[model samples]
Target: MTSETYPVDATNRVKRRHDRGRYDHATVHALLDAAALCHVAYVVDGQPYCTPTLFWREGTHLYWHGSSASRMLRNQSDGQPACLTVTHLDSLVLARCGFNHSADYRSVMAFGRARLVEEPGETARALTMMVDRFFPGRTATLRPSTGQEIKATAVVVMEIERASAKIRAKGVADDEEDYALPIYAERLPMRTLIGAPEPCPRLAGDVARPENLAAYREGRALEDALADAYRTAYP
Candidate 1:
């Protein structure tokens, strides 16, 4: 989408290479849905710290969990400004020249305030959402979260006031003169590799694969079928 179609507010500015930027809900949500981890940055006593954490998205909001005693969560619960970034590396473009080397990636940056969700039921729901975000139908099959487990966890909800997405996906761009140079150059791809599924040692030798584990059996991309499996098995 063009920048005019996806307007940016005071908080989210489309800086540098504005042509490659997007602010629409569809662009941002797509990147968020495909990602599992996010790097959260915040200021503490004039210093900045970026902590990596597991995250999930619900419409225009993002939820992340931390220990109840974590300093980041404690400060965020006090109503501090936070910046969350989610990124997916698609591939690496190895050019003939070092300066031309680059990576194909999609990323989203959100700016907003974070607050704690202390309610018992809401906290449990957030945890379940987190689980479903990664492995669909896992929460239902696993044992329910205990009360002590809920109490020990801290959930932070961030309203996406301003956000933008950046994407770079293409083959190597070589200068007209460089094309005649004697060098091998191309895009060497990288992807998530899944190995053969190994069963637990305690399972019976004759036990067959469960329906929920069929995705792994076919060697499919985790992001492609996770949500659908969750909806089918849990609904």
Candidate 2:
């Protein structure tokens, strides 16, 4: 069985609405994997910055990349403390009163110190892993990245020192007495959808759709489709 909880420190503690807090690794990873983008918060020269970037998980580490000259990447590469957050909005929840309105979402907040991944071999591998995580078997079909391209990029990873997930997946909630209100109270569910792929105008041959992308074209949720494709890919 998978572990039920992750160690939470003062930084990772969820003080408000504690009922929605989940400390398990599964919950954190689930929220992280479901989203492709994350906002990384850190301090630079005592001024705070929250830079949005694309990130991916590999084993126990979370990795993100950027231009080597990026200030955010340069600051964090030296082991600066940071917080990474991934959130997916699930719905607009309407309640009987404006004060009780809320949104359904799955979100994870992780605290950690960053590490610069400088080794050429590891850097290359990290790039490949991210590609495969988002598009299974895609790395094999594409040409290997040259050393120059790799050198131009900076890959930094974090150990995920402590993390917690806050989830609100249910419908609207309101006070008992408010249920008698005359206004219509409802929940509007939301989703991130993938549309059919458009082919390139400079096409050479008849390129068939990859099985993984085909599922996405059929309207499967991005995370669910990726999971299904990866499971079948290895088996």
Candidate 3:
């Protein structure tokens, strides 16, 4: 059975302002599912690198893909240690003092060993899941990937060993004395809003937008749309 919370070890223990840290699977998974982009940090030949890419979660594992010739993918193909992180900025807090000014955000850092998914079947399935992750039911509307296309794509899966989530979603946290100052203090919420879908100009007029993408309509919050897509795909 999987533990309800990830173990708090030296690798994942929160040191500063530990009250903001969360170890529960619910918190970690929710944050991961709400975002599509992540940074994978790894060391190669004494050099540190962090590559930003699109990723998806499946149970305890995180999956990402890139060109088979990608240096980042090749380096991580041999079960190399990696740290994946995701951050979602929620608001900008303008405090009375410069030191007190901080942004609200939800972030997660997961440690794992990334290895290439070499199996043909598994790689194909992972790719399909990646597409359906944001456009549920749309995969079935498309043609199957050619063998060459599949071979050119490299899929990597990392089983999260330990993870920690830190979130600050509250308002301005100014000092008592600073709060009493005349300086203005407020929280400006931030949002990633979707815009109207622009269909391909060369497409036939008969082609209409798929119903599965209705959740991604204009003015919708990106995080909310992604979360909805995840639930629609998995639920």
Error of 2 at 170 (Å): 3.4
lDDT by residue for model 2 (1-235), tens: 2356778768888889889999988778767776778999999989999999988875457898888889889898779999999888899999988898999998999888997798878987888866776777788988788878877888889988788999897788999888888889899988877776787877768877676556567466776765554454434
Model 1: CA > 4 A from native: 1-11, 203-209, 226-235
lDDT of 1 by residue, 124-188 (tens): 78888777766666788777878788778899999887899998887797777888899888886
Each prediction's number of clashing residue pairs: 0, 0, 0
TM-score, one value per model: 0.85, 0.91, 0.97
What is candidate 1's CA lDDT for residue 197? Answer: 82
RMSD of each: 3.4, 2.3, 1.1
Error of 2 at 234 (Å): 8.7
Sort by TM-score, best first: 3, 2, 1
Rate residue 12 of model 1 by lDDT. 73
| Candidate 2 ranges beyond 4 A from true positions | 1-4, 229-235
Q: Residues 49-147, candidate 3, lDDT per residue (tens digit)?
A: 999999999888999999999888999988999999999999999998889889999999999899999887897789999899989888899988888
List where candidate 3 sits over 4 angstroms from the true fold. Answer: none
Q: Sort by lDDT, best first: what order?
A: 3, 2, 1
Candidates' C-alpha lDDT: 0.78, 0.81, 0.91
Residue 162 in candidate 1, Cα distance off native in Å = 1.1
Give the Cα error of residue 181 in candidate 2, in Å.
Answer: 1.5
